[model samples]
Target: MARGSDRKRPDFYSRKAKASGRAARSVYKLEEMDQRWRILAKGQRVLDLGCSPGSWLQYAAEKIGPQGQAIGYDLKPVNATLPAHAEARIGDVYELDIEALGTFDVILSDMAPNTTGDRKTDAWRSAGLAENAMLIAQQSLKPGGHFIAKILEGGDVPELIKKLRQNYHKATQTRPKATRKESTEIFLVGLGKRH
Candidate 1:
């Protein structure tokens, strides 16, 4: 019989957070996606959802530079201060009007639903968040734009993937090196918006 003491531990995020000077190691996931997909560019407009702690915003601000613009939103206030070029709004993403923010070259969502320890329930909630973010992306993203968002391990992900495929030139799922091995979380990256 296996004992609880025998369970393996994963610390990829801790090590990455230390090395990268980020609030959380999840920033590397965006970095990896950007590297693989070339989603970010100089002078482009970017939006970040659930951007608390501002790690993704920090990375985006650095990548987009002064000529570019990066806007972030979250229900809770971000504890970290952002760069001069980056702006953050404290609000719910689902309620926000995407048109008011203008079109973006890239949209990134790292939103995670509050986990209840029930796998199925958690998955559904996470998927809902992803769905909302996708709708916002569709409304505000420029043609040929990019989107990256987090999703749980289960719940109608195939359908979501199919829809993404229809809207983007390519859509892929990636588990970044920065994510803990024990976590069921994954990222979906959509590139080259179709319309």
Candidate 2:
């Protein structure tokens, strides 16, 4: 068997982003999804939750083009180097005032609560964030819009998936090729918002 140092670690996202001159590796995740689902369109209004490094914001801004708008929110201040069309806010998602920002055509969330090493606790925390993102999407997304969020593999995921299916015309899970194989995290894409 190869030693840990000798084994090649996969980082497809970083490699691709570096080749394309993007700020963060996470951009590839959005790119792949957009290519497959065509969830984004020019001039659409987008909201990005937990958008720290602002990779998703960058991807959305480019896809939405000049006429579109992208807003990002995170618990901490985002770096000042984001694209001109993208805006960032430092705030908690649960306390966010969606009405203040107005409705959006797409709501994307990459929120993952801090891991505590305890599997049960981590799962619960992650599920809470997923649920919160869903709530925000329900209030902010326009009819036939899109909602995307990060969720852990265990705990209440089944229930959450059911709930998402109820509110969206189609709900699917995705493990982007950019994500590490060892990670249990997966993204849930809810398309064609029902409410």
Candidate 3:
């Protein structure tokens, strides 16, 4: 038997995901953001970064429909079966060539640093990943596209937001209800990417 700390507890979202045959509970986060912000649309090409377990890609595939394509990349392999419109590859974000992959209508990143237990270190690392995602979005997103990236609250976040504001028509941040209570992660949404 597992100890109290070692035991896994399924929350309401997790149970819903299992019932709906979704990859993971993280799908709901993207759902809420998309619903509230009108991010994903049918026939839009999407690029998903750090898409391990592929919950976001699954959600994107449904939103974008068969006419659209959702491509995902992550350090770990995704074992789930993806929709015909979606595909995932194992790769590091830092090494990816955004230009070679071509442009996208939407770019999403759920990357987080491997936690070190120290909040500051973790947040800083998350900031770095978020920055990289922003760079990819800037380079690869078509005009009037959208970008969403997850970043832990850290000192560097304001600087990152400043850059987002300069590059996108509208830049905002949100903490989705699906996020864990203790998690410091917040998502930065950049709507209407400027050329």
User: What is candidate 1's lDDT per residue for 1-195, written digit by digit as tens?
Assistant: 001111234366656566767765667788898898788899999999988767889889999999999999988777676778899889888789777899999999988877787889888988998999999988999999999988888966888889899999999888887666556778888999999
lDDT-sorted candidate list, best first: 3, 1, 2
List pairs with backbone clashes in candidate 3. Answer: none
User: lDDT tens string, model 2, 137-192?
Assistant: 88889989998888778858788889889999999889888766666778899999
- What lDDT tens digits, residue by residue, belong to model 3 across residues 1-195? 001211147888778889999888888899999999999999999999989887899999999999999999999888878989999998999999777899999999998777777889888888999999999988999999999999889738788889999999999899898887767789999999989
C-alpha RMSD values across all candidates:
4.7, 4.5, 3.3
Can you give the TM-score per candidate against the true fold? Answer: 0.91, 0.90, 0.94
True-structure RMSD for candidate 1: 4.7
Q: How close is candidate 1 to the true structure, as a TM-score?
A: 0.91
lDDT against the true structure, each candidate: 0.83, 0.81, 0.87
Deviating ranges (above 4 Å) for candidate 2: 1-10
Per-residue error for 32 in candidate 3, Å, reads 0.3
Which whole-number lDDT from 0 to 100 does residue 129 have in model 3? 90
Best by lDDT: 3
